[model samples]
Target chain A: MSPSSPSFAVEFDEINQEIVLRGTMRVRSPEEMTDATDLIRRSFGHGGHLVYVNIKRLTHLNMTAFRCIADVLTEACLADPQRRIVIVASSVIAWSAPLFETLASAQPNLSVEIYDSAFYPGQTFVEDESFIPILRTQTKMTWRHEREILPRHGMKEGMAIADICCGIGDFATLIKRQFNPTRLIALDHSKKSLEYARRVAAEFGLNSIEYTYGDASQMLLADNQFDFVTCRHSLQIFDRPDILLRELYRICKPGGRVYITNEKNSHCLGEPHSESIRWTYDEVAKLFSHFDMDVEMGPKSRRLLTDAGFDTIKVESFMVTNLDGDPRDFADVIEAWENVYAGQMAVRRGDSPDFIRRFRQGFKDHVLAALHPKGYAGWPIWAASGRKPF
Target chain B: MIERQVSPEPGAFEQMASLTLDTALFRSEFHLCDRVSEYLADIVAQSHEDPARYANFSSQLINEMIEFSFRSAVPTGQIDFRLLKNEERVRVSIEFAPVSDHQPDWLANDTSAIANGHPAVGDLWGLADAIRVNLHTEEHKENHVTLMADFALLEAVR
Candidate 1:
């Protein structure tokens, strides 16, 4: 057979001193990988003491390709005694870690690191079971607005659906109940969250939701498998929302829609203490930015979807007010946000006590506004969706 | 029948899938290894406790055998692929006709030697202990090699 064309790409991140290899590689000869080998060599010459080779998205590698890449990495290790080469692989791909481990054995300077952990910077803060109630309440508040907004974005019954980064899966359950999709798969990175989701599904007798644990950026799910893909309140927290969005687009079928929701924390408003709440929420946006998350991504949903190669985009904004449900429920959601964002994250970020005190006061005032007899508390969200062109 | 000899017990396992394809067709597409392994792994993994992990693990092991067949089988003969499973182990058996005149070196190597050692890294068969090599030839008959590998279905400790 004529030599198969290169099926992989190697990208070097200069700032991070990392080389990422993505896609399957089944070349007929080592010469086919000359470009990648040369790039890796050039990257090593940049005088970085440590370089990470990320093969997390490398789904397949034949022996010829394996030896080719391994030879380049081995040479790099030997050239610089002080230079350490870390091969970042994921357990999601079964053969990667085991195959690379052999190469690590031969080179003392090389090691294999399994990267199957949190995909988002705020993952730990959000995945804690302590946050489950808050997430459910947040979903409860948002569903009121979203249920009305979903159909305008192409959500309908009997479509194969996937909810990527489904968190506790409350929204998926809600979708199943409301839309009765033909097939619904809910995927999340957090095992604990999936367990809780499965348990909740069982409790609700919703046995059909396939709860799976996987990295959102490199899911094993097949391409063009879902007709309607919904990722809610997720893109804003990931360090690389573009990568996550790309995966969402990949899984969405042609002529199908990919729906997403995000928050512009700075726009969160309450009438009674509007100014204080505004200040705190603006700080919330800044705090998220410090952790490489963009809580201000709500308004940018249209641009993000458009840039991800989706067309016929539909975008809308909604405000979840105290009047949507029990006012105390709204107060409870604000209180949880204050505890996590102001109490934990601010402290973790080493904010001054005065700054934290002021931050805490904003959330408290928002809670007060929610409880006020006639006051209005609003949490604004942007819902945007686009159809993958046929 | 060859799988029964390699497996721990003859009647303990149930067959999941069996296929016979022209080696030329199988070897022509490199991605067939990935596609076949993934398809079979997905089927067997449904009854597994951890379906995702089991599918991943099973896919790798199955791919190894399919890969071996892709490399070693004659350019234009039939290759048989079989997947069998029990509570304890998942077995992949691949049978293909070798060059009619002589046996390949890998089949000639003492299979017991590999079965005894830690699967050596970079060795032709990277996964050694899991594999059992068998060759069958008779008077006036073409020689064939059957490469079988078993993967244990153990609950993850982590």
Candidate 2:
């Protein structure tokens, strides 16, 4: 195999009892995949009743490579019927689930599981169309700060840009109009969001931005393809922020910067009802934590990027105040947050009626503070960037 | 230069692009199959309803076809690759020049084996709606062996 062509890695995580097969493997013969077969055999040595074979990131595998893997898995299944081998595939990669299902048919002890929810716990909650208005309003408020802040973090006109996890693509359209990137690709996993994004782009007569659907953790986009990569308010939503950061680093050109924005919900404040707003926003952080998300990840961006092998780090905090734009827009965002957080998430977590009422009151009070002539409401966001080393 | 021609049938396959490379160079490295396949897949995928899914399927199919040719085609010639698409189907056609005397036997053997559902040519090729092995001696100045395969544009996940 050529060095520049797609490659594969088989890594066994003993702690997780999972063997992750990543990248592409297309070889002339089974002998070329001895290392992968050896890894699977070694994984069997570990004492575990259930071993997960994760092929979610394995983008390409020809029949020869597939046959080699299938043979190893079949042997493992036959050797120990007491143990089960689960082949985990991703729904985003269309070929994997069906292809692995064929192997499951022959081996009774082995089965194929399509992994969607495990990767993205908040997919259903965020993809709801009702959240569209709040998302647009949130962007409208953040863009005001980001447009001035972006240039400090290496954003300039005519540079290639990619907006990873760009929900509804409103931010990308704003970037296009402001920065005039030579190439702009806005990628999101949610099909509904991307559809809405495309329609909005068309209505606004912005045709240059390429809207793509893809998983943020394992993107099909080629390596070192973008000069500036921005993922806004997305790192906190993912269960594996590290995996998402690794991808952002991969797509960024050497010496180019990757900028990210995240929120610290507990830091949200309102003057007139500071006590109520503070209590509710703290609960908001706990609520997201229950779903495996980190709403307080804003302050941790620097450490995350540094550990991901980025240098020249720059971090700043911005507060979206009710006074920044029309106060009603800020109120609308707070109201929508109440519906999703109190009505949906809190209820799903089986909170009691009294707890829900208290939670709902906080949002209503924040909205009241936003509309009050003498009151101020603010939502804190951290914007940080680190340059990929040359 | 590689020539491109759309199917004459109304609403049938419209030619997308054609690439020509030295057969020896293509066969020398295994990765060329992926590079070429990915390039074509990227082009065709843009028009699909689900670009990511279609790109993955198209790349797999195209890579398999190229790999098959890498193993079977004559070593010294130009490999002409063409991509064509219509509303319902996408076609990938590869043509390579065979040494004059080898054309008849190759054309007969490939066409018959493929028609009889032979596995020697690779089972994944069966996914194609039709596989035509033809000798286009008149199109070029020499005997060119053309291998064309058509795949349906699946509405749902395949």
Q: Report the lDDT tens digits of candidate 1 across residue range A77-171.
A: 98997999999987666667777887787899999999875557988788888998888999999998899899999899999999999999999
Q: Indicate the residue-level lDDT of A199 in model 2.
A: 96
Candidate that scores best on lDDT: 2
- My TM-score estimates for the predictions, one after another, are 0.87, 0.83
The lDDT for every candidate, in the order shown, is 0.78, 0.81
lDDT measured at residue A335 in model 1 versus the true structure, 0 to 100:
97
Ten-residue region with minimum lDDT total, candidate 1 chain B = B131-140
Mark the 10 consecutive residues where model 1 chain A has the least summed lDDT: A1-10
Q: After superposition, how far is residue B129 of candidate 2 from its true place, in Å?
A: 7.5
Candidate 2 residue pairs in clash (backbone atoms < 3 Å): none
Under CAPRI classification, how is model 1 graded?
A: acceptable
C-alpha displacement of A117 in model 1, angstroms?
4.7
lDDT of 2 by residue, B68-115 (tens): 667666889689999887777667778887555443344333334445
